[model samples]
Target: MSSFPDYYKILNIPKNASTDDVKQAYRKESLKTHPDRLANASPQEKKTATEKFQAVADAYYVLSDSQRRREYDALYSTRSSSDKSDDPNASSTFFNTFANMFASAAGGPTGTTGDQRGQRPDADHVFGDVFEDLLRPEVESRVPWWAWLGAACGAGIGFIVANIPGVLVGAYAGNRLGAIRDAKGKSVAAVFSDLGGNQKAEILRALAMKVLGSAL
Candidate 1:
């Protein structure tokens, strides 16, 4: 009898893991097993890593959603019970039932045929969504105003002491504005337009310090 994959086992997470826990686990596992990270490894190693990465992404896709998770948990529990039963046909029946249910849930063909039984459209869509979410910037809590002020002051002091060209400093500051927005979770342009001249200068200063500090 065909067996269903244990998603929690794939993700190395507990069955009762929270949504945030699943997200964190997915991020950690994806990074560790990413194909790009295995480029320097042997072909076999890269192949194994790619499979593992896909499995982790699939597990996260299922466990991250409330409805899908509940359905998976229920299916898993029933399958477990069926596996322990002494009836010869119990396991086969369980697999067939699950395949039909999974196919329906995934919006694919619902038949006992191997191709239909293994279809997973929802999994593919969820995988894409997970990757997209990972690529996008999330809004984070803002840093304190005083912290920005201090960074600006420190950057200005560094520039003066190093005798850097004003044009270069301005260019560096401009480029770092995007980083500041990502870090602060706000529009850099909006901040400048809404605040007074001094505040804008401080923001630019803080951004410059951030870029310079990373370089140093």
Candidate 2:
């Protein structure tokens, strides 16, 4: 229970306001201090508006509900004239504690709970972060270990498949050529013919250059 909360003052409702009066008070407060409306307000004003808005919202929540309002009235009247600073959570902690203390207590706030986020578990959405922290670097990379081996094997197989026909043709042509030789002591003409028509011409031109200098 908060000391001197003055729900009437908080909601701008008069001392003798009724249920509808409490609701209208809350509607007006919500309109004025809702975060969207206060976005352009100065920091000090925004803070003040936030406090007032919270007070009004809490007041409306209790006053609008019949059973809750009765319990709230008891607690509010008990604390209205009492000292505050005595309890840290005085403004926010009363209802749940009061209900737990009183076996017969029961009720949801009438139109709005005013504690929407407070009622839900904050760690449900946060659990995944804890899980991510564990699995973060443990999962192996797609390119790691045997994946590289498989890629290398695939590349080698593809290279051999691509060159097989040309290698066979070169061997066949080289075998058909007689024992032509160069200083290397092998069939130079056969090797040139194995390089195919254009390559053989290029080889002949290069050999001529070697024998006769640039005039070749």
What TM-score, over all chains together, does every model reach? 0.46, 0.39
**Model 2 weakest 10-residue run by lDDT:** 120-129
Residue by residue across 1-216, what tens digits does model 2's lDDT show? 235345556667665678877755555554444433444579987666555545555566555556656765665565535443222134345434543433344443223334332231122122222222221232334434333443445455545666765455444333322112212233444444455554344344333433343212
TM-score computed on alpha carbons, candidate 2: 0.39
lDDT of every model, 2 decimals: 0.53, 0.44
Backbone clash total, candidate 1? 0
Query: Residue 15 error for model 2, in Å?
Result: 4.5
Q: Candidate 1, which segments miss by more than 4 Å at Cα?
A: 81-216
Q: Which candidate ranks first by lDDT, i.e. highest?
A: 1
The deviation in Å at residue 191 for candidate 1 is 13
Candidate 2 stretches with Cα past 4 Å from truth are 1-4, 42-45, 80-90, 93-107, 110-216
The residue pairs found clashing in candidate 2 are none
